[model samples]
Target: MEGIVGYGAYIPRNRIKVEEIAKVWGADAPSYKRGLMLEEKSVPSPDQDTITMSVEAAKNALKRCLINPKDIGAVYIGSESHPYAVKPSGTVLAEALGATPEVHTADFEFACKAGTEGMYVALNLVKTGDIKYGLAVGADTSQGAPGDALEYSAAAGAAAFIFGRENIIANALESYSYMTDTPDFWRREYQYYPQHGGRFTGDPAYFKHVMGAAKGIMDKAGMKPSDFNYVTFHQPNGKFPFRVGKMLGFEKKQIEAGWLVNKLGNTYSGSSPLGLTAILDVSKPGDMILIVSYGSGAGSDAFIFEVTKRIEKVRDLAPKTRDLLDNNRRYLEYGEYAKFRQKIKKAS
Candidate 1:
């Protein structure tokens, strides 16, 4: 009976179009549109950080679940871009959530996949009856080098899920994880942005880990690509997932069902979960959804979910990703984007 009680997502109100970035740097402007398959990327305001984003996502999720904050026995935040270097962001989130003193809370970091890793931990706790309900959040404000290709695509967003035994909306059927010492992408403690091995990240890192975990889940679950009604992957860029799907015998139709990257860019920790939220919006009862997440250093986690009758009833509580994208937005200039990203500093 342990399953997802509710889910929510938070996308910022501002965006930066790839075309604008392209136009600003000249005709070729890094080929952001062609290379990353991103049209616009979400940009959080100065006041909004990982903590604020997670709180918003968690609040929406709690509203959908209709559970009192006191009932939440545990809260976990997964992020690499925490607002404070020393304080546990989860503690700040728990206070914002108004959870009781009995709550157990902590933060988690595993590169970009940390959020999904939090979900996995929350699921296990709920399944064991150690907690009646738990909240797992994934959020990030990722950065890239000033002129690096990742600059345009790195974005911000957050997703939250409440796990419990009652009122299950989607049941986790099976999960598989693949880990390796692949250093396709990484940033050191003092580094401002991540370093990538370029083509190597695609061939042996992202593709290899994602495919291994995905195939492992499919093999264990006895399901095929056709069995899933929707499939979502951690989108570093628009082309990687599409190309990986092709290699695995899945067509564009299956991959495009999410189309998250084209609109939202790579949200780092929020990427796959945001894609899953997109799937849930259009998914029907009994539909199957498969999710895969990848992080540099590198590793992949794959999950299989089956929607239930309760999903229809709970659908109205959260605004879908499409609604979020269409309804709210502010535009920023390249210089403003640079400032927000801390690529440039203002005079004191």
Candidate 2:
């Protein structure tokens, strides 16, 4: 069966807390924290961007599988923050991993769903035996207007997965996607920051599509919430996942393993994919995992993965997601964060 041969995640070391951002905007820090259920968000350095993070993440995935980079048949990267408007991010990523020349590569974008969108395509390519291995990456240097509601939680990170028929760790059982032209969020070309529908992004957009896909997959598999050992939802904030999980009959414990939003904030395309990496790090054989990712253009992608015995053998081959998230961290004030995120204008 086509399944995950290896997987890895990368989160920047620099972080900025919600209080720091709220202070800068003269908003009530406690209210922002309580309302968003967010503490701090990861911040990319002056040097890091979508391409650099994707390279680091793909390198970690390669370490886990110990696969020859030259043999990788395809590379797909999904992000809203790709450095070049005209160039493909996958070409740079493939060259960095030495997977260039004779490899298929493309960049994808669909708001937050871009990452899994790439994963969906990569998996299909591998499953059809058109490629020996395919690399799928979801990464972002997510942006929010300074002092806007989005500033408190938009963060940076990347997750990469390798798929193949042999040496599987998590077997791909079933997958489903749901979409609508709701336009709850968007960024037009030449726009520096994304505009959202505010409260309009809630019921008609996020909840509806997420629930539709999650229920669709479970129904297709003839499974229930209790049938899965772990479940991860797109963590736009710390609140929505828990709220949605409760509504779906998933217990807190089932969702806790992948619930890193309070500390990591929203990594956009990296949200649910990063959560799944954390789950895979600790999951045991025969454990069932369900992951549903929501993208703000009003869509969701859901997948069912069954852990195999191979998981244990390859679990320690790369850095664990939680370890990268919690250890050796640097906390930044709003000033430094703005500089790093290039929110400040420099005199020419």
Candidate with best lDDT? 2
Q: Predicted candidate 1: what Cα RMSD to the true structure? A: 1.5
TM-score (all chains, Cα) for each model: 0.96, 0.99
Q: For residues 194-239, could you state the per-residue lDDT of candidate 1 as single tens digits?
A: 7889889887889898899899999999999999888888898889
Model 2: per-residue Cα lDDT over 1-348, one tens digit each: 999999999999999988888888899989988999999999999999999999999999999999999889999999999999999999999999999798999999999999999889999999899999999999999999988888888999999999999999999999899998999999999999999999999999999999999999999999999999999999999999999999999999999999999999999999999999999999999999999999988799999999999999988989999999999999998889989988889998
lDDT of each: 0.85, 0.94
- The collision pairs in model 2 are none
Looking at candidate 2, what is the lDDT of residue 215? 97
Q: After superposing candidate 2, which stretches have Cα over 4 Å from the reference?
A: none
Error of 2 at 307 (Å): 0.4
